[model samples]
Target: MRPDSCLSQVIGMTFDASVCDMFCAWGAGATLVVPARRELHRIVDYIVDRELSHWNSVPSALAIVEGLGQLVS
Candidate 1:
């Protein structure tokens, strides 16, 4: 990702994926957007509205997004 990219910080701190999310974004000099718990229900919207360029999360979270019919093709 580019330095101007925005990365979604969706995974919890306890998860290893969160580490990757943070470090990757930092390494790339990208912005990291961390949504509040209340905002997670519409994470797809958050990602789109915030213009997030990268996302790193567990499979189940992705499944939820896919189930919502919001995962991009």
Candidate 2:
């Protein structure tokens, strides 16, 4: 499926779902993944092991990702 389609599926998920750190990109729907904090590793692992994609964060978070080299693309 297209990236947008995958993102749409993610956004339709219920809030109670285990996923966290939802990022919405322009011209596309939301990309769901877990935050990268150590405490959130389990969730992050789950998303990464599943090979899911996510939108890049904005500003401060983006800087963090860049520093950590985890920025998508």
Candidate 3:
């Protein structure tokens, strides 16, 4: 999708090792929320509570979600 089209979707993106890519994405108008750690429960809670539509994370972060059984689709 076009970057401009994602302006309305509040996206929670993790910046563990890479900052440039994440920053560029955020600069394109995607609302970004960076958590303190790889806390899947907290991340999911934040996303759900804030009604976020997208997220970007490392594979390890995805594993956390899987381990907690909180993967949404």
The best candidate in terms of TM-score: 1
**Looking at candidate 3, what is the lDDT of residue 69?**
80
Backbone clash total for model 3 is 0
lDDT of each: 0.83, 0.40, 0.52
Candidate RMSDs in order: 1.8, 8.2, 5.4
- Each candidate structure's TM-score, on Cα atoms with residue i matched to residue i, is 0.81, 0.27, 0.47
Query: In model 2, where do residues sit more than 4 Å from their true spots?
Result: 1-47, 69-73
Among all candidates shown, the one with the greatest lDDT: 1
Name the better of 1 and 2 by lDDT: 1
lDDT of 2 by residue, 1-73 (tens): 2344322123223553323333333335434343335533343344556465643223454465457666467
Give per-candidate clash totals.
0, 0, 0
- Alpha-carbon deviation at 54 in model 3, angstroms: 3.1
Query: Using TM-score as the measure, what is the rank order of every candidate, best first?
Result: 1, 3, 2
Task: Assess candidate 1 and give its lDDT.
Answer: 0.83
